[model samples]
Target: MTRIKKDFSLPAVFAGFITFLIGISVSSVLVIQAGQVLGANQAQISSWFWALGLSIGLSGLILSWKFKYPVATSWSTAGLALIIATGSGYNLNEAIGAFLICGIMTAVLGFFGIFQRILEFLPQSLTSAMLAGVLLKFGITLFTVMQDQLIYVLVLISTYFVSKKTLPRHSIVITLLACILLTPLFFEYTATKIHYGMTYPVWIQPEFHWSSILGLAIPLLIINMASQYLPGLAMIRSYGYKPHVNQLVSWTGIAQAIFAPFGAFSTNIAAISAAVSLDEQVHQDPAKRYIAGISCGVFYIFMGIFAATLTGLLLSFPREMITTLAAIALFATIGHNISIAFKEDLDRDAALITFLMSASGVQFLGIGSAFWGLVIGFIIYHLMRIQIKKPI
Candidate 1:
């Protein structure tokens, strides 16, 4: 593909802005939900949102500007599971300690450039399986929603598919149009008031605990590196962009290290949802893709500053609309990850184990099953290899 000259045109920024605006509310809720579960007070929780928003937004803009690529940054989704696993009981101090250690580990991995190299070593099948596991909810959730509103869902699906084939660059627009037209028919909103205002950071001092290493630090560190970092690199590579892995990882860790005490759990590359912003319908050129992410970061910072207003809007938005739109937006990626996970003959069995384990949502002790998904996959793969080689 011929390179498209870098463009920082207003249209480009606006396109990126819209994409970010769409994704910010939903993604921020997930990030905030985790912090809230940890018993982070309002001030601290607000700061978590601010910290993540600022860190991701500013870092994304600066890096994308410097590299002239559509580079985006986000916190680890795996951290969500960790908050569920070790919520409330563990003081904020321990959580900060775990965050500090994990951030250091992530920066170290990036500094040595091992993140990209590990991407090479991971078997294609296992990576695919991991993605399938991550996206299972995306594929299934849409159909469940469709059952209640067949006409609307089908209309949206048809519009999206028809547009994807006929006017690929306009597919998202078609889906979006379908959503707006159908919203009133299916939406159950009795009230709607939008708010936007600035918020302040809430800071806390870090406290170290050796126990948190085994309890929280190791699992979070492992998941962020493997699930979020590795997959994010693969995502960018799959899009045919050469990401600056070392610098990206280094800064991600530094950002988290600085913000953890304020209730930020983990920050790194985003693998799964970055597609929503980077799709050709929104951003046509690989180099210009960073513009979409940069736009998203700015919106995220806006949410950070205007925490009260955005939070209320998010709380008041119609559930069905949000669910239906999210599920539909996620369909293509769900299909892609599923195929990668189970299609290879050599790695199918191990990949299956990984997928099942991760999707099971199992928690043993205080660590989530996602971390075990990697462990179990590697174990089963090597055990089978050893068995195959042994003398009869």
Candidate 2:
């Protein structure tokens, strides 16, 4: 469309690519570990990428294009973590069935508008606090790596600040370039080890079992809904985007259900990686930022097609470098969220509780800190309200 052409920018495209890179490089190992734990071979492992890439790409593309918002979708990293944490008790077939069940459950919840209704009651301050907590890990890792790789991180940070002042629109782009270009100087390049090719899908027959349904499927549904979608929607809202929560939930759920046999265990809103495309560096006008999502979709499909090769190439970089770069990219976003969380005097105490709880990384009954943070904040906020309104 003419509007698409007019809105396109190199910065936004880079933001999308960064999103793709971060999504893959950050937790792809978890995908492989989960696959291996479920007794998958190399081919099945590659298919995980294929299925995940296509589902996320298609869903993100459709949502962003239709809604004119940067609605990026991603495979559930938290779900993969859950699978790995659960050990190898279940076989691949059971995992696939569990995946299908989770998808169906999510779709049903969204179709009935239940998911949207629950999110509607969330306070913006609490949501912002949760998002900040979600992002704080990256910031902490960035500095931790700085202690070990001081010169390297200093260069990247200096580049970010200098470029931010001189070329505000392209600061992250420039910083990322510096990160890549300077990598060889600080670390070794392993290009020769990377193999390139298309990733073919491998389908496994699904079998339902109560053990997996209760142990894996139900827990997966909970983790993804709380850990991924909730914070993801909060991230979108933190940046002032009003996403159609039901459509997002239902479509990704449907996509996951259809592609479960092909190794797509879960697909949901890409919270952290999506933040790469939400910053001002992607686009000056919030209205035009949907281009970043479209670009991210294109990159997702590209990576999906060459799932094996591109994933290896992206992962070739050191983890510290990728994590640090991601943290730098999120600095502005994190700062914005923190300010919003404490902006209202009435919300400050509860928001602080949420932020601290989320950052603490505590988990109970397999759910993560982000979910607990929201719960605690909700309780505190309501308690504060009752206290003020009580008859003395």
Candidate 3:
């Protein structure tokens, strides 16, 4: 207890808080879209936020404490995207059942160390390329939003650069502050009346169908693993953190299973927000960075407790602003991954192929582009190697 208390700092707490804000801001829209597609009503949507927040909070707290690392957790954005795209046929109850099955499969993979082995087989360049591809859309969205909201975007960008140069550690926070202050001036502010109390999680009795399992469950599991979890692990590796891969996988899978019935689709290691918490600016002492994760867990609990109002407030933000924030927060990560993706001579072409395929967002069958990108990239890489060795 004393040691834990000693490790705590305001910088760590602020990092965690900012990370949660950025994480929720970036993907809450997608989560809501997915929930709506699954035929969730307003109350169910609130419950979805509640369940996700609680699960991520608890999992991040326990994992960080046990592992003594900033083990940030989040919902799988790609899984949500898949749900939104392919879940039109399935009702909410069926979707919940599929979520349960997906969680179980994920846990099985973790327990058997399958995910870790898969990561071992994957080269760094390929993973980096996939990550870059996944994040490329956000970079594009940032600039596109800038075109319409040029002045606001310019102010935010200027604040970010100035803060980055001066405050360094609080660059994101400073930019966020600028947004909060500038938003009401350009856009009308509507106060959302949130019920100031603990929100209970709503339970939905799951109805499992074989078709749902094959269609929603399997595809969701694959995308979450390939697009979210795989890149998430790669992000941790990129930051030079040696996380317990199997442990994170198993714990997140367990979390998903526990929360699925309440509309939490999938929980996994966070890629972007984890980067924020794992940064040296969060804490100079790497060993004490777990404080940031714990702080994030606490903030998540607060968000869960006021899930309805918080979701409403976040949704009220202008779309352009939200996209801009996401882009700025992710810009560093996108740049880092792209650099690493092309660093190796042997893997350069393969990585580029993966990047283009993923960025193209071309989905085949029911699976997302990220999975296909990896498959195609891997195939091309091996084929090129074979051709190189053959006699001319």
Candidate 4:
């Protein structure tokens, strides 16, 4: 205990907070888009912030504290896609109903231990291609920094390199410090002036519909589990920690169910981007990463309370800043995923199909690029298998 405590300190937790901010910033637009779908008026939009902030905070704290790993939580990107895709067709209540159904399905999947099998069915090649597709755009965006915000971008980039070289553990700290110091100097603060205030969760009642249950619920469950949950489990393992997937998934599902009325959308385990926290807090014993979770939770609750102001603050940042930072942060993973996407000779055809389809950003019946990316990968993979077995 003493050794672990000695390794982790308040400073480390603060570093995690910086990464947490960037992580939320990573996909928050999806959240905002979903909120708009639900007829999220000012207060309700603020409640969207409240729900996500509070959920992330509580979930991050409990899991990170309990497992001694930083278990990041985020609004379900898949769920957001579902709501946006079908939102106009369905009211908020029906969407919530779909969300609730998805949550229950996810919880049941975790409970029955079927999530392990689902990924196996997904084909590793397809999943890799889909992942590569999802992250490729952001990877390009990293270099897109030079187009705008060049000075601060260069400063942050230099800070990032220097911190890695000199401060090692403090690399992200230095990067964040650079962003804060440079924001006012080079960027227009007026662009980012958002209202900061307290917010309480606003509940939206769920109304069940067959269309929502099948169209939104089932697909949402698949995407959330395949893309979000499975990746989250791998994230923990990548950091050399044994993750309790069932416990994490089940708890996240149960919590999501509990919060649906307030437009919580979906809450689930995080990955890829969540890795930033793990890396930033590397020297700290893995178990102590909970402290970072705790800190993140604290910030989450704080933000939820001030959802309006914070939302404004988040909205205030130049769109390019958000896009570039997110894109740059993803550069490393995109390269790695692309390499893996093309790695297997057996899986090559499928992976390429998935990668191309996903990057194409084509919406087939509005299903989104990620879903089709996997679909194309699998189609190619199995089709090749069929071709090889046919009379030759």
Candidate 5:
């Protein structure tokens, strides 16, 4: 009892809540879109949320306690995006098969320490640039939201600015409170009736195909490693935390494989959403920040158990409001990465190219821009260095 009191704090709890809010708001739609693309029924879709929510919650809770750090995990947004983009003509069973293969591949790489070795060659600037580029859209979306709901957004923005100056540590907390209070009054949203029932996982037997394996499984694994794990570790490292990259990747893959039959697509370490709880404002002492992860874990479990009801509740809010909140939560993180990416003059041009490519949302060979951004930036960085070394 005494230990719990010393470890848990309101700020830390709120940070966890904010992390959940940002993660769900930013990416849950993609999950739904992917499910729809794969022709999943409503029950299957709900199961998807349930399985993923449970896996992510358990992973974060256990990892944070074990490592004594705020280690957060999330579904692979890039992988989901891939599904939505190219999930045509594939049955749900085949998609599940691909997911299983991807999970196994990720686990094998992690267990062998092969994944970390691949990341070792990546330059810090490229990683930072890629992160900044990935978050660029959220920041832009916040202001774009202002056009639709000017008063609502203005209120939230005003509260954020005022709280930032007066209550620096709780600025986001205050803004979130204002958002919750104002939402009911301003938005004509019908609250989804809360259903009090445990969600049952719907299991579908997997059937693998060469096309699914080649098209989905391999690409999913690549995105999970490059787009998800790389930036997630970078976020933790930026905050001075030495994450066990191998173990983190291994566990997420194992969890995904265990739950893939129930529609847990791909779970990996969180990059942007994790930053919400990882911030210094969450707590003065970094050692105690694991509370946020635990809190997030609890929330994730609850959300999963009531996946159907909560999914409706989350979707009830206007997209603009969610977008605005996401922008506010990630504002500091995006700025910090941008500064780091451009800090060294030698790496500036390569970093800029990486940032532009990532933010552009381009897809080449069915892979996301973040992976390509790293590749192009690495090449440019070396070429520039080699040219500088040559005698005139």
Candidate 6:
């Protein structure tokens, strides 16, 4: 604890704060939307915030403290998207049950070291490609929004580039500040009423059905593992962190299971936020970067305590601003992954195929493009290998 205190620095703490803000800004609305789709009332929606914030907060804190790595955790935004799309017929209780099943399955996979093994079998190029593919949508959206909000988007982009040149370490901070200053001019700003109180987690008793398990639970599990967890792990590995992958996975699953009854869908390693925490600007010494994770965890706990207020504030940001922020934050990550994906000559073609497949956003049998990208890439690599081995 003393050592942890000594390692803490203002930049690291700020980085964590920014990371938390990015995480919430990027996806809280989608989570709220998912809650509404499931017919959740106001209290249930608030419980979703409480459960997600507390679970991710505690997980990040515990993992960072134990491993001394910037092990950030976040709710599964993809899972929420899936729920909004496919969980229409399911009641809240059935959705809770599906959430529970997904958590248990995730935990089981982690306990058995399945995910780690799968990662081991994957080539670095393919994984990098997968990550790049996953992030391409955000990049596209950043420019697409410019069609409607031209001046605001231009200002945000200029601010980001200028800040990157002048103060690379605080580029995001500067960009966000610029956006905040400019937001009221371009958009209507309304402050939501803040209800100051401790948010209690509401437990919905699980009611499992075969339909929910097959349709909701399994798909949610697959999406989290392929689209979220895999990319997150790739980011961690790419940044040269040798995390206890199994422990991280297992613990997130455990945390989700514990909080699922409270409307928490799924929690997993955070790819975008984790990248923000790992930035060199956060801490010169990579060894001390765990302090950022700790700081983020502390902030998450605070967010959970005032879930209602924070949710309102997070929702107050306009869609374009949020999307732009997310795009800027992820820009470096996308570039790094793309570079890594095509670095090697032999794997270049396979990696590109994987990247295109992932970016295509194609889904089959309820699984996302990320999984299919990996599969197709692996098959292509093997085919190339077989061709090389055969007589010409």
Candidate 1 segments whose C-alpha is farther than 4 A from its true place: 1-39, 191-195, 338-392
Which has the greatest TM-score? 2
Kindly list the per-residue Cα lDDT of model 3 for residues 1-392, writing each as its tens digit. 78789998777887787678767876788887898898898788888889999888899989989988888888877777788878899999999999999988988999999889888878888878988897899789878987778888888989888888888777877777788789888776576665566667889999999999999999888878876688778877776777788989998899999999998898888866676677666777888988989888887877777887777677677777777877776777788889989998888889999999888888776566777888888987787677445578
Off by over 4 Å in 3: 26-33, 36-39, 384-392
lDDT of 4: 0.69
Pairs in clash, predicted candidate 2: none
Q: Give per-residue lDDT, candidate 6, residue 149.
A: 92
Q: Rate the local accuracy (lDDT) of all candidates.
A: 0.70, 0.89, 0.82, 0.69, 0.85, 0.86
Give the residue spans of candidate 5 off by over 4 A. 1-4, 387-392
- Candidate 3 collision pairs: none
The ten-residue window of minimal lDDT in model 1 covers 1-10
**Superior by lDDT: candidate 1 or candidate 5:** 5
lDDT per residue (tens digit) for residues 239-335 in model 6: 7788788999999999999999998799899876777787676776889988889889888888887899877777787888778877887788789
Backbone clash count, each prediction separately? 8, 0, 0, 9, 0, 0
lDDT for predicted candidate 5 compared with the true structure: 0.85
Please give each candidate's TM-score: 0.82, 0.97, 0.90, 0.82, 0.93, 0.92
Query: Tens digit of lDDT per residue, candidate 5, span 257-356?
Result: 8889999898889887888888776777888888898888878888788887787778777776778888887888898889889999999999999999
**Which candidate ranks first by lDDT, i.e. highest?**
2
Candidate 6 stretches greater than 4 Å from native:
387-392
lDDT for predicted candidate 3 compared with the true structure: 0.82
Model 2 worst lDDT run, 10 consecutive residues? 188-197
Backbone clash total for model 4 is 9
